[model samples]
Target: MYVSLNRNTSKWVVKKFEENHNHVLHLPEHSHLLKSHRMVSEAQAINIDIAADIGLSLKASHDLLSAQAGGKECLGFTREDQKNYLRTRRQRSLKFGESGALLGYFRNQAAQNPYFYYAVQLDKEDMITNIFWADHEMITDYALFGDSISFDTTFRTNKEYRPFALFAGFNHFRMTCIFGAALLYDETVESFEWLFKTFLHAMSGKKPITKGKRMQDNGTLIEPLNQTTEHLLSPKYSRSIIRID
Candidate 1:
C-alpha cells in the first residue's frame, strides 16, 4: 500500500494498492497474538493490579487471566504485554521520585491506621538509604508471636537490587506471619543496626526473646544485633538469645 499527498486538496490519498500479499496471513485463531489485536483493557488492568497486590508473579497473573478468558488465544494479550503494562504503571507511579512516592504511601497508611509505624534512614547527603515499615496488624501480630522471630535479608527487590529484609514469626497455627519489613541500602552493620532499632521501636520496644538470622556470612549481622540488644534491651530481658541459621 502507498499513499500520496494531494497539494490541491491538501489530502492524502491512497495511490497504490496490491491485492497480492508478500507473506501468508495469520490464522484466525492466532489473531489475538498480533500486535494490533493485543491490548490490556481497563478491566484487565484492574485485574492485573489486584493480582499484583496479592503478590502474583507476571507469569501467574497472565496465566490466570488466560484461564479466565477460556484460553491463551482468547486472552487478547500476552505475558510480555502484562509485564510492560505493570512496568509502565510503576514508572508512572514514581513520577515524583521513588523516595517521595514511598514516603507518601507510608504517610497515607499511617493516617489510616494510627498504629502504623515507619522509619527512613538517610545518608550524609540526606538521601534515603533505608526504610522500614510495619502496619497495625503487623504490630499486633508481633506482640503476640514475636517471642521467637526470624530476620532475613537474602531477598532483593527486582528493580533496585536492594536488600529486602523481613521480620517474621509463626502464628499458633504454625503459619508464617510477618512482623515488619525493610528495604536496606546495604548489608552493612550500620544499616542492620538502624533497621533493628527501628523495628524494636515500632514493636513498642519489645525485643524478641530469640532472634534468628539466615545468612551465609553472619559476622557482619551479629555485631549489629549484639549492639542493638545492648542498647535497646532492659535488664530483665538482657538474656535474649541470637541464633544464626
Candidate 2:
C-alpha cells in the first residue's frame, strides 16, 4: 500500500491497499548446463563395442577407454553415456538368441534318451500347447517304489511363463525322487488330468499299493500284485474312489 497527500487539497490518502502480486520463478544455478558428449571418435566407438562384447564391467570398460584417450576427458561425454550404449548392444544380442533356442534344446534332450517318454498337446493351429516327460530311470523308480506320489505345479521359468509340474515320491531308501515333470501353458483341470494319466501310463499301469486305511464299509479294497515273483494280492484304494491306490 502507498499513501500520499492530494496535490490540490493537501490531504493524506491511500493509493493502493493490496499486497504486491508480481513474482518470477527462479531456477537453480547451472540447471541448463548439461555435461554431454559433443563428439565420440570412431576408434572410441569401436573400442566400446569390443569391450562390451567381451563382457567387461561398465566401470572397467570406461576406465580402459579413458586410458586409451591418454587421460583426457571423454570429449564432453560421461561414463553413464558409455554404459547406456553397452546395455543396448547386449540386449539386442539376447533378443536374437532367444528365437527357437529353447525348443531346440528340448528336442536334443529327447533324442538323447531312447526310453524317454514325452507327450505334447497342440492347439487348433497345431502349435505346441503343453509338454510333459519322464525318463527311463524315472520309470524304473516308479515301478520299484511308487507309493504316495505327490505332484506340485508351483514353479515357472523362461520366457514362455509356463508352469512346471513335478511328480515326486519316496523311494526304498526313504529319499524323495522325481518321477516325471510337465511344462503346462495353463493351469486347468484338463491339463492336470492328462498329466496324471500320462504318469500312470509311463509306469506300465502299475498303481502304488496302499497299506493302511480305516474303512467303515464292509466291502474290501483289493489291489493286484503280479509284477514280481510275489503273487500275493495287495490291499489298495478306499471303498469310495479309484485313485492312485
Candidate 3:
C-alpha cells in the first residue's frame, strides 16, 4: 500500500477516522474553530515587491502585514510562507551562476564608464579570492590629492573571512575619498604585499607620499606595508618613503 496508496486520500482517511473517534469519545475536535490562514493576492504581491525594494526582510514584511487591521485574517499567510515566497523569487532572479552575477554587475559598470579599473585574483581552485577596483574619478582624485593615503584592513566582508582593505586619500576638497579597495584572502605578509603592488598598479604606479595605515596588532600592522614600501623605494621604482613612524 505504501506505493499504491494516494497520499492525499490516505491523509484524508486518517483525519476523518481521528475526528470520528473523537466524536465517539465525547471529545470536541477544535480543528473546526481554528482560523485558517488566507492565501496571498495580487495586491499583496505588489506590496511584497515594494517591501523588498525598500530592503525589508521577509519576517519584517510578514509582521507588518499581520499588524495591519484584519491583515492576518485577510492575507492568511504566515511569516514562513512569506519567507518561502521570497526564497522562490530570489532563486528565480538568480537564474545564472552566482559568480556571473557579480562579474556582470562590474561589466555593466565598465560599460557605463570606460575608465573604470578592476582586477581580480583567483585561488588555486580558480575561485575568486581577491578583487581590486577603482574608477576613473578615483584615479583623478589620487593624482590630485594622492600625497597622503591610508590603508586599513580590519573588516571581514564574506563567509570566507577575507579581510577588506581600503586605500583611501583626502581630495582637494579635504574629503576622504577612496583610491582603491581590495579583498585579501588572508592577512599574511605575502597577501598584503600583493595587494600593495596591485593597488599601485591600479593607480598607474603612483605611490603615496604618506602611506598611513591603522595598526591593529604588533605583528600584522606595519610589517607587510614596510616590506612593500621598501621594495618600492628601490632606485628602479624611483619611489622613496620620506618619513616612517
Which stretches in model 1 have alpha-carbon errors above 4 Å?
A: 1-97, 211-221, 224-245
Candidate 1: Cα lDDT at 41? 91
> Per-residue lDDT of 1-245 in model 2, one digit per residue for the tens?
78999999999999878765576533433222245324455777788877766767668887877776665343344577776555444344333443235456667777997787877665554555566778888888877777556555556654433478777778878898788888775555555556656767877877655443322222443232222211211123322322332
- Candidate 1 structure lDDT: 0.74
Q: What digit string (tens of lDDT, one per residue) describes model 1 on residues 1-245?
A: 99999999999999999999999999999999999999999999999999987778788899999999999999999999998787566544433366577799999998998888999886554557778999988999989988877666767675544578887878999998889988776677677768877888888888766533333234543454443432222112223333321
Best by TM-score: 1
As for candidate 2, its clashing pairs are none
Q: Alpha-carbon error at 83 in model 3, in Å?
A: 34
TM-score-superior candidate, 1 or 2: 1
Q: Write the per-residue lDDT of candidate 3 for residues 91-182, one digit (tens) a residue.
A: 33333344346667778889999899887776554556556788898888878887676666666664334477776666767788887777
TM-scores of the models, in the given order? 0.51, 0.44, 0.48
- Candidate 2's displacement at residue 42, Å, is 38
Candidate 3 residues lying further than 4 Å off, grouped into runs, are 1-100, 211-218, 221-245
Best by lDDT: 1
